[model samples]
Target: MESLVVPVLILLAVVAGVTVAYRAARKRKTGRPASQAEPAKAPQELARAAADRLSEDEHRRVYALIAQGQAMAAIKLYYEITGEGLRASRDAVGALAAHPQPFRRQEPAQAVEEDDDEPQRFPYRYRAIASKGDVTREVSSNMLNDEIYGRIRTLARSGDTEAAANALTRHSDISLTQAREFIALLDD
Candidate 1:
């Protein structure tokens, strides 16, 4: 038994080394990652966006499917209604399940305009929030990207609150008074 100890120790060390090398090589051969990635939208914001893509009846059915623990059915329903790819529909369903968002009427124009350059559809959504004291306001829309939001912020910071409010209302579904209230917090 004593004579076999050294050989057994060497065998174990060799096996460990081979296993480590195999894992390292496997990690290097993974599928290629996305070439470009947009900043992630908030999960609740995404849930709201997903819900907004559905019409009233579709929304009810999708939520019902989700409540019944039928994830695939919910995803399928969302995909059929929104015409999104399988992966996006799955992700949207997951987000919706994790965070329940209120149903706001989605404009038809806002739903299909994500692709501007080559007419590809994108599921990205944006949400802007402002709060002062006990008052808070939120704006969610597909039309409000980071650049547009930055411009609105710049306009507000430059003392052009009215123009900022106008721009906010143009990109979001909020009313002018609500936009003004939202803009006021950003000026600080």
Candidate 2:
């Protein structure tokens, strides 16, 4: 037993060293100790508002991780990016992946500080899908619903595609080009 003491002591010391290094690295990366708890975040449920919160690059990154089937990693990334609660991050990632959102440039009137010009914010998000051959696109937004989408579709079928595309862009986060592409699929 006396002869075995040195090797066991060395092994314990190595393990303790590794543990300390790992924790220090984690603290440096996250700006908090590994054992520290995260504070509560705003918005319990992720609506279209989640898409509104993430920047274009961050939105793409989260979706890419989800597409690669790394849900846990995506959740962790979204949690870090948005500083949202773990549960909210998970839900946001799931929602964002299921219905991909294109980045919409924020209009001056849409700022949160203004009360009067703020467009209506919805609790639920709506999805409208259009496909031509193997190419498919989806527009998901809180500003759209079944009745509104039907009207847009009617505008497309009536040979008023430009108007329809404009309406789609108004309702969703997609750009004019993307809205036109989506409208092309609906033109039939």
Candidate 3:
């Protein structure tokens, strides 16, 4: 009886030691804080968070595309990659067509200045995927508006010029005069 009791005690001690060692090994393998052990964010949620950082114009363009009834799948893919929605992307197009304000030439004497130097400003350009691949090209406000004008001209230059012109007049916000001007420019 004495020998059996002694062996039983030894076995219990070994089991406890083994359990402790196993737990330590697991902790080392994970190497994370206890609070961080909860489930991680999904890829889609992370993508949306990243997309939220896009510029206002970019956001407007994305929203505009959404308004235009583009596929959600395509919009989602674009948002994930470029951090822009359809509406924001389209608004960016309108902004590109507007004149830009000049950079401030001088600092105000009365204003308190900080230690940090002002960062250099550059011209804003639209980046679009063209046939030549991804191109970052500068465009004037006139050029930007010209894109809309050119589209109208292409439609009018085809088989039913009058019908195309009428369609442009009806569907577009631009006046009929503007459409005619664009068509004439295309002819030239």
lDDT of each: 0.83, 0.82, 0.46
Q: What is the lDDT of residue 98 in candidate 1?
A: 99
Error of 2 at 141 (Å): 0.6
- Work out how many backbone clashes candidate 2 has: 0
Candidate no. 3 TM-score: 0.26
Instruction: Give model 1 RMSD, 1 decimal.
Output: 20.8
Q: TM-score of the candidate numbered 1?
A: 0.39
Sorted on lDDT, best first, the list reads 1, 2, 3
Best by TM-score: 1
Candidates in descending TM-score order: 1, 2, 3
Q: Candidate 1 on 1-188: residue-level lDDT in tens?
A: 99999999999999999988877666666533233335678888889889888878888899999999999999998999999999889999999999987778855574544432232222777888888888888888877888778988999999999998888877777899988889999856
Candidate 3 per-residue lDDT, tens place, 1-188, comes to: 89799899999999999988887777777786444574754544443443454455655554455456664543564546575667653333333223222222333378644211231222543222112233222222212233443554566566455654454445344566654543443342
For candidate 3, what's the RMSD?
21.6
Return the TM-score for each candidate structure. 0.39, 0.37, 0.26
The C-alpha local distance difference test score for the whole of candidate 2 amounts to 0.82
lDDT (Cα) of model 1 = 0.83
In model 2, which regions exceed 4 Å deviation? 1-119
lDDT of 2 by residue, 1-188 (tens): 99999999999999999999998998999898877857534433344677788777877887789889999999999899889899888878888777677776556575455222243557899999999899998999998878778988999999999998888887778999999999999856
